[model samples]
Target: MAETLRIALAQINPHVGDIRGNAERIRRARAEAARLGADLLVTPEFSIGGYPPEDLVLKPSFNADAAAAIEALAAETADGGPGVVLGGPWVAEGKRHNGLFVLDGGKIIARRAKHELPNYGVFDEKRVFEPGPAPGPVAFRGFRLGLMICEDWWFPTVSETLAESGAEVLISINGSPFEVGKAQLRIDLAVPRVVETGLGFVFLGQVCGQDELVFEGASFVLNPDRSLAVQMPLFEEAITLTEWTRRDGRLVCTPQKLAPIPSAEEQVYRAMMLGLRDYVNKNRFPGVVLGLSGGIDSAISAAVAADALGPDRVRAVMMPSPYTSRESLEDAAACAELLGIRYETIGIGPAMEAFGAMLAPAFGNRAPDITEENIQSRARGLTLMALSNKFGDMVLTTGNKSEMSVGYATLYGDMCGGYSVLKDIYKTLVFRLCRWRNAHVPAGSLGPAGPVMPERVITKPPSAELKPDQTDQDTLPPYEVLDAILEGLVEGERGVEALVAEGHDRATVLRVWRMLDRAEYKRRQAPPGVKIGPRAFGRDRRYPITNGYTNLIA
Candidate 1:
């Protein structure tokens, strides 16, 4: 008996709250599967409401919309064609669940809720919805299948039960967002489940970018011995089918090796590029514009913008004040020229002087301090805002994570941008990225040849050029110390006492904590950007704006 099961993986991307579009996407995938003579097809987790719908899942209207869409998708298989397993929101007994709908013969055959809802590190599944009970096996065409949702596949008890119940294969539908090295880890994690259960395993994934997260779509099928049978490409969408022949009353497959994965920097850069491009293109922005200082942060951001939107679409303005050095001008010009993007220099000295003159009388009693220095930054911000208004271009904010953490950034000044592309990257990582860009231009770097970031920009003392002799280290701790403390305090959620107990100076730890806490208001006001770290200073980690409890500076 020559019997082969043709299963298709629909590596499609879905937008949050766009249920109709997502449902249409699933329909198209089903149609393709039927045409290709596929017996089954699966989409990634939350493909209907989109992965990480975040707070939108709370809205009753959105939930209702998702339910209706799910019914529509289920009704799609009415012709007894290729069966479909797709992600969508399903609520039962007044409780919401991150669910996968298994549709067959024009009706929903079975529903599986994600049991292991991740709560830590960029996940808040606990706050939003209750976890569902462990899933059982799904019967399909003379086979008992062990089906797991995105997070459920991480564990064994649920899948093991399905295997014990005589499951021929294990299938995992995932909306698993791609981080720096998550793809390899996901593959490694899937292998154990496959080998242990002695069953063929398939992982169907979503592709493209949504907000800060990017789905790599590295879908793969694994043999019973924990080896790859087939694999898909990264960061691209495709519908692929794997043929499995049943032998000895169990599914059998051949194993193959996946290609080499990209480096961390390469992954990060590509994610940002895809994220920025999709955000701009999907939102219908004509082009992107940014303020380019001679600093490495702006240099890197501009390069990314150029690479993402193309040099012709990336316009950069060098807004220099009196504090801005000639060397800065030279470097900024060089970097922009290297990228071959449109560059314009706008002098903010006159406007800054005007603002200073206007505020002189009001500030006569107070000593000239950060307030006045901030006036310069605001002046530059106003200029950029005016330019953005005059020409329809989205301004890219160049603030990095370190500055965002400690209120080192100026509000409405450098923060005046539609998106913060590198807001999640730390200062230490910024240096590494500059070096990385020089060594190898990833997908987002504008130039193919040499260093886009000037050596002086990377090697020079970090400065805001706010005053004549202002350096970042003059006010804040070294980047290594700062990043370590931030990781402990923010991501690790360690208290100040615990941080100090871990070989950290109490005073230094306290100082960093205080700075981070006080800067909460500024981060709250900042624009949304791509989140790289586990707990980015965005919706992932929410703290009160009004709080006097400082960890250090009393």
Candidate 2:
């Protein structure tokens, strides 16, 4: 008997609703696996319709399309004799199932519905999918294989079931989203599964950025001894084979070390870079452009673009106005210099003044206020849009989740980009990233030593630099306080009373809660960024923008 079992872990990126395209990708991956002489190929969960198709899976015709697509995938495998485990949505007897269609010898020989449908933290699978009764072990080329879906990995029962069912190895499909330390978490979780099941466990996770979520492709296999046998890259797509050995009927997974953790900024930096790269590349864009405010957000965005798509393809435009600070100018200049990007300084001062002059007559009695400040932003937006119009570069917006959740951003001003890069990051995480960059540099990073951001940018009072001496603290609580409350209210699902119980001030907590509730409309209009936390305020944590909601204690 041969000791080696060659299996390809395909970290494929699938676009939603593009069934034909996704099927084609599966076919291509299968062909590549055959070329490499792999015995089996495993793809990510819901690769056919992409992850979290939401209500789309509820459609009967869509599931039919998915079934047809799986037939095509099964037929391809019949020719090369390589078994495949592909994920898609299935409909049977008016119940929808998140199914894994196993194909060998060009036919759907075995199938399994995902047993666990997660209901919390970015998953609403229970609403759409009915639980499967039980699926027997899928036998392929003399091996009894167990199949597990995305959330089933979080539990030991699924693995125990497979072990009890005489499964020799466990192969799981996942659409797991990226977050800090999540790569390590995946491996850590898999260890117990392997040890208890007494079988080699392989994880195949989706890659690429979809809407607000970015899937970090750190696929790996763990031996029955609970040791990491093989590991893949963190943020790039690659299909590689991990060969397992069988000696004296004992399955042995080859030893492989995990990839080193990049700096905090480097981790976030690569995430955005890959997110932008995949979003642009998969969507078929030539390049990207963004407003460079010299602030931490845009500066980091431009730097990411330069690394993802070379400097030649990236354009950074600084749309400055009368209120734009000199420090902003210097920092923007220094950032562009550091990144080696194509920098342009387009003064919006003239346009801003003209717009103010045009509106001065109607605003005679009213003092210049937030409306006037926003006018400056809209003016800069117009200029950037004009430039984007001239050259067909996609504009990337830079706004953190904290500001987006609280209406701290201006529409048609800083919001004038095709995609938002830091939409999931809070202001506190933003500072953490800045410090992370100073400590550890990523591959091809062009930022400076000490800090890519200026000292004033970090330690000085936080401001939008929209108006003179206007600091963020003047209008809102500190980033530390605000982010904590948000995490409790949003992620931890803690109510206002609970927050107060947790030691937050009653008035302050209510004020922050109002800001978050009021800003729902703003978030609805904001561009999507990579989701790094449980509640990203976009597709993950959805609330009605016009609701009159209050959880404040008297």
Clashes per prediction?
2, 2
Candidate 2 accuracy as lDDT: 0.80
Cα lDDT tens digits, model 1, 317-357, are: 89887788888899999988888889999988888778878
Q: Could you give me the TM-score of model 1 versus the true structure?
A: 0.90
**Which segments of candidate 1 are over 4 A away from where they belong?**
1-3, 31-37, 58-81, 92-95, 126-131, 443-451, 493-507, 546-554
Residue 279 in candidate 1 has what lDDT?
78
Q: Compose the digit string of candidate 2's lDDT tens values, residues 1-554.
A: 55677888899889888899999888889888888889988999999898868888878888889999999888877676578888998777878899988898889988889887888767788898998865668877777778888788688888888888887788889998888788888998888887787888888898788766789888888888787778887776779877777755545666766656665566677787777777877677777888888777776677667767777778888888777788888888887776667888999888877887898898888987899889888887788778778887888888887787788889988887788678888888877776666555566443333344455555556667778877788888988999999888788878889899989988888888888888888778877777776677766787886786563542
**Model 2 spans > 4 angstroms off:** 1-4, 55-66, 79-81, 92-95, 126-128, 246-250, 261-264, 438-460, 495-507
lDDT of 2 at 437: 63
Error of 1 at 83 (Å): 2.5
